[model samples]
Target: MRQQIVEAREKAAKDGIRVQRARTPAPDVAAPVGEVTEATEPFQDNGTLRTISARYDLTGQRELLWIANEGKKVGDARCTQKFQFSNNTTPRERPTMLLCWRTSQDKSVVVLAVTPEGRPDTRDAVAKLDTRWSAMG
Candidate 1:
């Protein structure tokens, strides 16, 4: 997956697509949850524009960035959106594409359950988020 991130960014650059990433502050190792340092990996994805080092909780899922394909500037159009592949996945399938973006001040992970355009399936999942990342509010 990490290798894919690297390759994807390279590809995006060649295609003139912007990419981004972000990560939360690292925990103290014994901070209850798990090591969060791995969340700060470098952005070597081949086709990325802006790589943000952040994390998001979708529903109850601790989402991680596996790939960031493209990015659109905030308020440049409607939303601060980017194409991404999330590490969180079900037992039935692999990590899929999602719209990891901001709608207000909160960032969110819009899971693409089954939209021909790959839209977020759970509306409330994004609504519950505090960061500016959402689709339809």
Candidate 2:
């Protein structure tokens, strides 16, 4: 099943679609949860303009970027959102990260990463992270 998803992503990339595999921060790492310091900024995602909601230096490695439905604070309940995949034969729960332009030929957003738990579905804290890399916040 994972292989099928990989193949599909590869096909999309070949067609000019951007797919991002979100990286999970190590369990032992910790960082400050910062406030939103900039207004929504416009960025080029594969030549399309997309707006970024906020950015923070969560891990000090890179600025965490996000797009929220409305104004929100750092580490607030609304900071994270749920995304479901089309495949659901096993009804597994996985945390995923996605970003993209609202309008595009494929209407496909970049899938940054997906992590599945061995046990019951547990929400991944990484999905709520501010790990997006951007030049301007």
Candidate 3:
């Protein structure tokens, strides 16, 4: 997992995009299980800044609640167990997508992808992360 993040950063740099560690404040909710691992970076996409982030090791109903609450704070949030992804968008502001799933290793994961309003939807970006991370055990 760490390797993937490193490769992503390197790839962004090679593409002439400046990627920076996301500086958003952590959510107020506390995790009750294993330590949560997070990796986030904001980079330029077609002249617009976009963000991609992931949190790992979440394991409980409380964590799911946290995800739901956080998504609600942003926009109309919807979660699907089958797809293991959440959709949240603030059409008045930005478009964001959140995905959560239990890995083969039994670890719960959440990923977020965001793009400025007026840009394309974040489905593709979130889907890419879903495909990449879902394979990790």
Instruction: Choose the strongest candidate by lDDT.
Output: 3
The lDDT, on a scale of 0 to 1, for candidate 1 is 0.32
For each candidate in the order shown, give its overall lDDT on alpha carbons: 0.32, 0.32, 0.41
User: In model 3, which range of ten residues has the least summed lDDT?
Assistant: 82-91
Question: If scored against the real structure, what TM-score would every candidate get?
Answer: 0.22, 0.22, 0.35
Cα lDDT tens digits for candidate 2, 37-128: 32332222322122233233343112223333331233322322333222222222233333221112211112122223222111222222
lDDT of 1 by residue, 7-44 (tens): 99999999997664443323532222322211121112
The model with the greatest TM-score is 3
Per-prediction tally of clashes: 40, 9, 0
Candidate 2, residue 3: Cα displacement in angstroms equals 3.4
Pairs clashing within candidate 2 = 20-111, 20-112, 21-112, 22-112, 22-113, 64-130, 64-131, 64-132, 65-132
Off by over 4 Å in 3: 1-32, 43-105, 131-135
Give the total clashing residue pairs for model 1.
40
RMSD (Å) per prediction: 14.6, 16.9, 12.6
Off by over 4 Å in 2: 30-137
